[model samples]
Target chain A: MRAIVIQAPHDIRVREVPDPTIQQPTDVVLRVLRSCVCGSDLWAYRGESARRPGQRIGHEFLGIVEEAGHEVNGFAPGDLVVVPFRWSDGTCAYCAEGLTTSCPQGGFWGSVGSDGGQGEAVRVPFADGTLVKLPSAAATDDRLLTALLALSDVLGTGHHAAVGAGVRPGSTVAVVGDGAVGLCGVMAAKRLGAGRIIALGRHSARTDIARTFGATDVVAERGDAALAAVRELTRGEGAHCVIEAVGTEQSMRTAIGVVRDGGAIGYVGVPHGSGTGLDLDAMFDRNITLRGGVAPVRAYIPELLPDVLDGTIDPSPVFDLTVGLDGVADGYKAMDERTALKVLIKP
Target chain B: MRAIVIQAPHDIRVREVPDPTIQQPTDVVLRVLRSCVCGSDLWAYRGESARRPGQRIGHEFLGIVEEAGHEVNGFAPGDLVVVPFRWSDGTCAYCAEGLTTSCPQGGFWGSVGSDGGQGEAVRVPFADGTLVKLPSAAATDDRLLTALLALSDVLGTGHHAAVGAGVRPGSTVAVVGDGAVGLCGVMAAKRLGAGRIIALGRHSARTDIARTFGATDVVAERGDAALAAVRELTRGEGAHCVIEAVGTEQSMRTAIGVVRDGGAIGYVGVPHGSGTGLDLDAMFDRNITLRGGVAPVRAYIPELLPDVLDGTIDPSPVFDLTVGLDGVADGYKAMDERTALKVLIKP
Candidate 1:
């Protein structure tokens, strides 16, 4: 099987790897139909994250069940499913609370001991806890495939930010970033009945997508200017909710600054950078809620799947480019150079 | 007139001072009947916070309105009132949202340019927004005065912690501290209908007060030991809500440590140390909510006052020591030594 592997910084390759087999009673094997590049992947690709030679990469995938372990229930071969970024045992206390991302038995894809998702086939641990089965009609709908693939990561993460910030009817939300995840955050806020959506980013192309995703206003400013613009839009009170999708210290601070006192800032970006400290002094005095970590994509997948299936939302626009598995390096380049919002790899 | 003045760390004195008079159209003069030394006041008393040689000190008070400014309405001479720690213009956007502590025109008592509450008379700015008037019968009700005084700071702050953490029916709450504010947190959790209340502190006397205030369990351990105890109580999942009343980094970390994933930590202790940073790495992955600052006492006073007056809650027990204005230094010493949970000063 051909899989994506990082040989070194700025070096991605598609090499033949052994096919995965079910190793545990609850494990299943999946034939990945589609996999996408995540923003976190860029950290390693740019030589920022700790990556060793020949490391398997990627965590987001839409796939078909190729084999199932004996303990797996409600799933069999040929079933289409959305695979969350992490695998978990469904019955743990954290899983029972719908926080699969924090499940004690959970482990990330493409890590030291686990098979990566950007491959022709991979072994999935805790199959019953990690996969959300889609209706049979999904197999025949090419137009819906990209959006379904997004459910594996970015879109669900955006939803997590919105819900974490307590977005509801009449909420004024400020989404800090215009990346694929940030654009999706705009859509999530709209779906949750946010009355005003402000997208903060400088790139015209990304901001355009943000508008399409239901952003009511776009502020192409940084630092104090961006904070001022959000305050201006919100009648000097700042947004009722802020969705932080960029995992930088400055992005988190901007999200905190533009949120009204007693409001919330929901952050979904994987934290990066050195010395990224939340200013407890400011957060304490403002009574602002800072909530959000990794998204529980498994928990959110079920609730959001029906909406995608019914054509109520199409998150496909986030994928600006698509390529064959052989073009995987260019896919990473396109995203790295900011020429594409996201790159989809058809395996 | 006389007022409590801090000449230096550990030096408290009641000295002759100029009588307070209205300085703004919205100001009102109040004859303070009672004032209390707060945990935060000890910070200044210990020379931790900025304090000047002749600075007026207390901020928690129950008083009788002796004079009203022309613009002040619904309050007049001889009306008893509960004065919050801060004052605000009732019409600001934050005030409208019930976040009076963050009101644009708000300022804390004893702060530069503001009169403190320990004086015989105080010129209260934003009288309509800062003072909650009690029924005239309050003057004759001796038993209710201490409880009413608690509404000014500690009790209201505890309530803020519980409410900020979103305490609700069936919520399992862990209170970190057993000071006056922490004991009050137990009561606040009870008032909010928390099913199981865990008080984390080592003092037997304070724990007794915590039990009386409705703590179902008391964990006297500190650091990781305390975390283990809380985990043991909640079936290894941690508590649904954690109220952090101690401002140290270790206390903050313990609160974060014991909170279940997707749970909240409501902190009200005034931050004292430099570089008190929340580990966003841990918080981001666990999806914990860190909220709380200064309590919006004015916003909460209305809802809590009736219960105190009706004998439904006896917050007076928290004030274990009583002193006259001349004994202000002893009041600070007693609390500093942990010999008294709190001290009430009769002006």
Candidate 2:
């Protein structure tokens, strides 16, 4: 089987790897149909996040179940399913509370000993708990399949940010970052009925997509200017909710600055860099709320899937580039060079 | 008129000061009936929080309206009232949003050029917004008055913490301080229908008050031991809601340690010292939320007043010492030396 591997910083390769097999009673083998490069992947590619040579690299995919163990009751061969970034046991206390990311028995894809999603086939543990079955027809519909693939990570993460920000029918939301997840956040806020959405991004192409995703306003400025622009648009009060999709310290600062006093910030970007923590004194004085982390996409998928299936939200637009399994390195390079919003791969 | 003044660290004096009068069209002058020494005050007393010599010091009090300005529509002379720690214009956007503490026109009592609650009279700005009218009968009921006084700060603060923590029916709550505010948090959690409440404190006396207020369990451990005890009590998942009323770095760390995955920490303690900010890495991985600050007591007064009036909760137990106008100095000393949980004053 061909799989993407991180050989070194700025070096991605598609190489022959041993095929995955069901190793446990609850395991199943998946033949991946779709996977993509994520904004988070850029961190390791940039040598910012440490990664060992030849480590598996992707964590988002939708696929057909190629094989199932005896205990895997919810899924069987030939069934299409979407996999969340992390796998959970579904019955743990955290999982029951809708925090599957914290499930004690769960682990992320692409970890040291695990199979990455950007591969021909991978072994999935806790089959019933880790995979969401997709409609049979989605296996052949490219557009719908792309949208369903988003359910595996970005769309659900965006929903998590919106939920964390307390987006409601009349909320004013400001999303910081123009990446795929941030664009998805705009869609999530709109789906949740946000009255106004302000997207902060400098790129015209990304901001154009943001407008299509339901951003009522776009602030192209950075730093103080961006803060000023958001405050001006919000009548000097700032937005009621802020979605922080970029984990950089500057992005977090912008989020803190643009959120109104007493408003909340929902931050889902994987934290990287130094001094990324909140300014406690400022947060305290303003009575602001900071919530969000690695999103529990598994918990959110059930709710967001219906909208996607019904065509109410088409998150497929986030994928601006596509590649074949052999071109996985090009997908990583395109995303790294900002030439693609998100790169989808067909295995 | 006489008022408590901060002469220096460890030095408090009740000295004759100019009597307060309605200074603006929105101001009301109140003749103090009851005021209390707060744990926050001990900061200035111990020279931790900077205070100028001769600065007025208290910010919790109930009184009779001695005079009202032409624009003070809701309050008049001879009316009994309870004052929030800060005065906010009732019509401000923040106040309308129920975040009165963030009102642009709001100001704290005891600030420079303002009369403190420990004085015989106070000139309250935004009379219609800052003061909640008390039943005329409360003036004579010492017990009810004490409970009402708690609404001026501690009780409302506790309610803020509970609300911030997302306390719901059947929640398991942990309160991380034994001060008046933390005890009130226990009561708040109970009032909100929390099924289990854990109070963390070392003092038997305060924990007893916490039990009376509604703490179903008490953990006297500190640091890792405290974290271990709370995790054990909650079946290794920690509490669903944690109220952090101690502003020290250690207390904040304990709060972070004792909250369950995807749980929230409501912190109302006035932040002091270095390294009091959140550990963002840990929070991000666990999906924890941090909220709460200087409470919007003015907005909460109306909701909590009815409970106090009907004796549903009595926060008076926190006031273990009483002092008269001339004995304000001793009140400060007793609170500073930890001889009293809270000290009530009559002026």
Candidate 3:
């Protein structure tokens, strides 16, 4: 089997690795049909997040179950399935509370000794609890397949941000960041009935997609300018809900600044660099709410799947570039260099 | 008129000040009947919060309307009323959204040239928006009046914390701080039908009040010990709702530590010292929510008034000491020395 591996800073490669097998009674082996390079993967690629010399990479995928353990009653071989970024036992207290990311028996796909999703075949733990079955007929549908692949992480994450922000019908939403997650957040807010969405990003191509994703307004500015533009768009009152998809201090500050008094900020961006220098005093004075974290994408997949299947939303546009397992390195490079919004991988 | 003034750090004086009159069309002159020294007042008394020499102090009061300006439509002379710490124009968008503290036209009592609540008479701006009417007959009932006075700040602030933390029926609530606000938080949690309430405080006197207010368990520990105790009380899962009534960095950390994954912290203590040293990384990883600020007490006064009137909750117990207007200095001294949980002032 071949999979993406993080060798060092700015170094990602498709290397031959041992094939994954069902090691636990609850585990199942998956033949990866589709996967992708995430903005978060860039953390390791840039050496921003530490990674071992030959560690497996990537955490998003959709696959067909090649083999199922005896304990996996919910799935069988040849069944199409979508995997959330993290695996969790559905019956755990946290999982029951819709916080699967905090499940005690859960773990990430590419942690220490696990199989990376960006490979030909990977082992999935807690199969019955982790994998959501996808329609077998959708495997041949490129558009639907890509959208379902997004459910593995990005789209679900965007939906989490929206839920955390308390987005409602007729709400004015402001989304920070123009990354794949941010674009999906625009779509998610729209799907949740947001009357208007303000996308703050300077990138033309991404902003165009944002508009198509239902962003009623676009603010191609940064810092105070962006805040001013958003405030101006919302008639100086700011948005009712702000989705923070960029996990930077400035982005967090902008999210805080552009949210209306008493409005909430749903931040799904993986915190980086000074870790969201949030000013408690300012937030208190404004009566603002800050919620969200590593999204419990597993809990959201079921609710969002029907929308993707019916084409109520087409998140596939986020994938402007596609590559095969052999070109995984190029996919990483493209995302790192900002040449692609997101890369779809055909394994 | 006489008023409590902060001459300097550790120097409180009852000084004769000019009598207040209707200043704005929306203003009303109130003959203060009851005012109280708050935990926040200690900030100015300790010189932690800078104040101008001889600045009038106090922001909680229940009084009789002495005079109403032409534009004061909701209130009239001789009407008994409770005033929130801040006065806001009810028609503002933020006020309409139930965030009276963020109203654009709102201003805090004792700010700059404004008359403080501890004064014999106060000129209240936005009278129609800031004051909640009290039944005239209860004015002579010391117990009822004391509880109603609490609705002016403490009780309402506690309710804001519970609401911000998303308190629901059957929630496990944890209150950090045993001050008047935290004690009131216990009562507020019970009012919201919380299944269990855990109070973290070291003072026996305050914790005793907490129990009567509905704390099912008391953890009289600090720092790590308190965290461990709370975790144990909730079966290592922590509380679903945490009320942070102490604004210190340590208190914020404890609130964060005792909150379960996907739980929220409603912090109402005016941030002092280094402010809430929030670790966004930890908060993000745990999916914890942080909300609440200077409470919009005016928005909650109505809902809580009926309960106070019926003796369903008696927040007046927070006032452990009482003083006349002439003994305002003694009231400040008692509270600053921690001999009093809260001081009631009669003018």
Model 3 spans > 4 angstroms off: A274-276, B273-276
* Deviation from native of the Cα of residue B79 in model 2, angstroms: 1.1
Best by TM-score: 3
Interface Cα RMSD in Å, per prediction: 2.2, 1.7, 1.5
Considering DockQ, which of the candidate structures 1 and 3 is the better prediction for this target? Answer: 3
In terms of TM-score, which candidate is stronger, 1 or 3? 3
Candidate 2, residue A243: Cα displacement in angstroms equals 0.3
Q: Where is the poorest 10-residue window by lDDT in model 1 chain B?
A: B271-280
Ranking by lDDT: 2, 3, 1
Going through the candidates in order, their DockQ values are: 0.66, 0.66, 0.76
- Reference-based lDDT, residue B316, model 3: 84
State the local distance difference test value for candidate 3. 0.91
List clash counts for every candidate, in order.
2, 0, 0
- Which residue pairs collide, candidate 2? none
lDDT of 1 at B147: 83
lDDT of 3 by residue, A40-126 (tens): 999888998898998998899999999999999999999999999999999888999889999999998788898889889899999
Candidate 2 positional error at A72, Å = 1.3
